[model samples]
Target: MEKNQKPLLIILAFFSIYVIWGSTYLLNKIAVNELPPFMLAATRFTVAGILIFIIAMMMGKSIAISWRQLKNTIIAGFLFLSFGNGVVVWALRFVDSGFAALEVSAQPLIVLVLMRILQGKKIQLMSIVGVILGLIGIYLLVSQKQILSQENSILGMSMIFLCMLSWAYGSIFVGKADLPRNHFVNTGYQMLMAGIMLAISSLLFNETWSSPWVWSSPVQLSVLLLIVFGSIVAFTSFNYLLKVVSPEKVATSTYVNPIIALVLGWYFLEEEVTLQSIMAAVVLLTGVYFINTKRKFMVFTRFFRS
Candidate 1:
C-alpha cells in the first residue's frame, strides 16, 4: 500500500464500518419480516463463510486451523454471532430498527461492567459517569409507554440485552483465547461455526425455509446486501482499519453507527424517530465517548485487534 493510498483506504474502511454496518439493522429488519431470523442469519453467514474461504485461498492464505483453535472459534462464534447477532435479528421482528440500534448503542457500557465483574477491573471516575448517563438514557428509551405497550416489545428488548452481554463477553474472551493467526481465517471459522449453530436453531424452532427464488425482491436484496457488504466487506474493512489506525479512532464507529441507523430507519423504513429517542441517543453516545478514554480504550482494542 502506498502512503497516499493508505489514507484513502483508511477513509473507505471507516466508511464501511460506519455506514455499511449501521445499515445492517434496517436490512435485518426488512428480511426478518419475510424470512425467519435464524434461517436468514444462517444463510447469510454460511454463504459468507464459504466466500471468505475462497477469497482467502485466492489470496494465498491458508484456512487450516488446529483443533484447539477450532474449539475456541466455536465458542467465540456462538457467543458473538449465533447468539449475539442472530438473536438480535430475531428481536427485530418485534422492535423497530432505529429503536434496536439505540438500545445496542449501550454496548460500551455493557463491556465496562463486564470487565469489572469478570476481570475485577476498577471503573474510572469518567467511566462511572458514563455508566450513569447510559443507564439514564436506557431508561428513557425503554420507558416510553408506546414502546412498552407494543406486543412482545419487552421480550424483544430483553433478548437484545442478553445478546449485548454475549457480545461483550465474547470480546473479552477473544482477547485472551488462542485462535488462528490470520484474522480472515479466524473470522471464517467463526462465521462457519456460527452459521451451523444458527441452522440448528432454526430447525429446532421449526422455522419455515423457502428458496431465495420465492422470496420477495426486497427481502432477497436485503439478504444479499447483508451477506456481501455487512458480513464480508465491512468486516474486512474493520480488521484493516484496526491494523492501520488507533483503536480509539476505530472505536468512533460505536458513536457514528447508531446515528446512521436511526436516520436510515426513519427515512427508508418510515420508522418513528421520537424525541425521547433523539435525547437518548445524545446521552447514550456521549456516555460512550466518555468511556473511550485512553485507559479504558485499551480494553476495546484488545478484543478488536484479536
Candidate 2:
C-alpha cells in the first residue's frame, strides 16, 4: 500500500469499528435476555478467539510468544475483555441498550484520565475540553425519563462506567506493555486468555448450559452474529487501525459508536430517540472532532501564514 493510502485504510477501519461495535450493544441486549451474561460473553469470545487463532496459523503467522509476553497479554485481556466487555453484557440486562452504549462510549475520556494519572502524561487542553463535553453528553443521555424511572438505573450506569474504566486501564497497560510484533497474533492470544477467564467466571457465577439449548433461534442467531461481527471482525479491524493510526484518532470511533447505537436501537428495539439524545450525540461528536482536529488546524494555520 502507498503511504497515503494507509491513512485512508485506517479511516475505513475506524468506521467499521464504530458501526459494528455500536450494533453489538443491541445484539448483546437480545442475547443476554436468552443467555446469562458471562456465559454469553464467554462463548462469544471463545468462538471468535478460536477462529482468529486458526486463521492466523493458516496464514503462516507465528502464534508463539515469550512466556512473559503471554503473561502480560493475559492480564491485559482479563482486565479489558473479561471485566470491561463482560460487565457491559451484565449491565445491558438491566439498562436500555442505547444507554449502555452511551455509557461505554465514554471510554476515550476515561483513557485520557488513566494515561494522565498512571503514566504521568500531560493532559492536553483539547482532551480536557473533550472530557467535559463528553460528561455533559452523558448527563443528557441519562436524563431520559425512561432511564430516570428505572429503580436500578444508578447501579446499572455504575456498572457501565466501571466497564469503561476497566477497558481504559487495559488499553493503557497494553500500550505500555511489550507484546508480539504482529497485532493479529497478539489479539488472538489476548482473546483466548480473556475467553478462558470469562468462561471460568461464568461457570462460577451463573452456570447454565440448558438455556443455550432452550433459547429461540433468533437469539442463537444474534449470538452468532455478535461472535462473527462484533468480537472477531471489529476487534481485528480495531487492532489494525491502532497500528496504522494515532491512538487519539482511533479513539474517535468511541464518539461515532453512540450515534450508530442510537439509530440501531430506534430501528430494531423501537426505542425512542428524543431531541435531548440527539443533542447529546452532537455535543459528543463535536468534542471528539475538536480534540482530534485542533492540532491539524494549528498546522494548517501555520502553513498558510508562512
Candidate 3:
C-alpha cells in the first residue's frame, strides 16, 4: 500500500471499528431479549472464533505457541472477553444498550489508572481531571433509570465496573506477554479459549437452557452481524489500526462508540436521550480527550508558560 493509501485504510479501519463494534451493544440488547445472555455470547464468540481459526490456518499461520505463551493467552482471553464483555452482555438484561455502552466507555480512564499501578507510569494531571469528569458523566447516565430501583442495579453496575477493570488488565497483560507473531492466529486462539470459558461458565451458572430451539429472524440476524462484522471485521480492523496509527488514536474508539450506540439506540429502539445524557456524553468525551491527549496538552501548557 502507498503512503497515501495507508492513511485512507487506517481511517476506514477506524470507521469500521467505531460503527460495527458500537452497534453490537444494541445487538446484544436485541439478542438477550430472546436468548439467554451468557448462552448468546457463547454462541456468537464460538462461531467467530472458529471462523477466525479456519482463516488463520488457511493463511498458513501457525497455531502452535510455547506452553507459557498459550497459558497467558488463555488467561487474558478469559479475563478480557469472557468476563469483561460477558458482563456487559449479561448487564444488558437490565440496562439499556446505550447506557451500557456509556458505562463501558469509561474503560480508557480505568486503563490509565491500571497502567499507573501496574507499570509504575506517572499519571498526568489531565488524566486525573478526566477520571473526575468521567465519574460525573456516569452518574448522570444512570441516575434516572428504573433499573436503579432494584438492588440488582448496584450489583449489575459493579459487574460492569469489574468488566472494565478486567479488560484494562487484559490489555496490559497482552502488552507484556509473549505470544504468536501472527496477530490473526493469536486473536483466533484467544477467542476460542474465551468462548470455551464462557460456555463452561454459562453451564455452571445454569444459563444453558432458558429458551425454545425455535429461532427468531431478528435474533439470528443480530447474531450473524455480531459474529461477522462486530467480532471478525471490527476486531481485525482494530488490530490493523494498532499497527498503523498511534495507540492513542486507535483508543479513541472508546469515545466514539458510545455516541454511535446512543444514536442507534435512539433510532432503532426509540430509546429516549435526555439532556442529562447529552451532558454526560460531553463530559465523557472531554474526559477521554484529556486522558489520551494529556501529553500534548502538557506540551502546549509548558510552551505557553515559557
Go through the candidates in order and give the C-alpha RMSD of each one to the true structure.
3.9, 3.8, 4.6
By TM-score, the candidates rank as 1, 2, 3
In the range 170-263, model 3's lDDT, one tens digit per residue, is 7667665776666677777777888888889889988845443476888889989998998778876765554444444556788789888999
Which of the numbered candidates is closest to the native, going by highest lDDT? 1
Q: How does candidate 1 fare on TM-score?
A: 0.90
Q: Check candidate 1 and list the clashing pairs.
A: none
List candidate 1 segments past 4 Å from native: 1-13, 237-252, 295-306
Evaluation by lDDT, superior candidate among 1 and 2: 1
lDDT tens per residue, model 1, 1-306: 324335556677888988898999999999999999999999999999899999999999989899999999899889978999999999998899989888888888888888889889898898888888889889989999879999999999999999989977877777667888777888788889999999999999999999999999999999999999998888767655544554335556778788888998999999988898889888988888777665634554343332
Provide the lowest-lDDT 10-residue window in model 3. 297-306
Q: Model 3: runs farther than 4 Å from truth?
A: 1-9, 145-147, 209-213, 239-249, 295-306
Best by TM-score: 1
Model 1: lDDT of residue 95: 92
lDDT against the true structure, per candidate, is 0.85, 0.77, 0.77
Model 2 pairs in collision = none
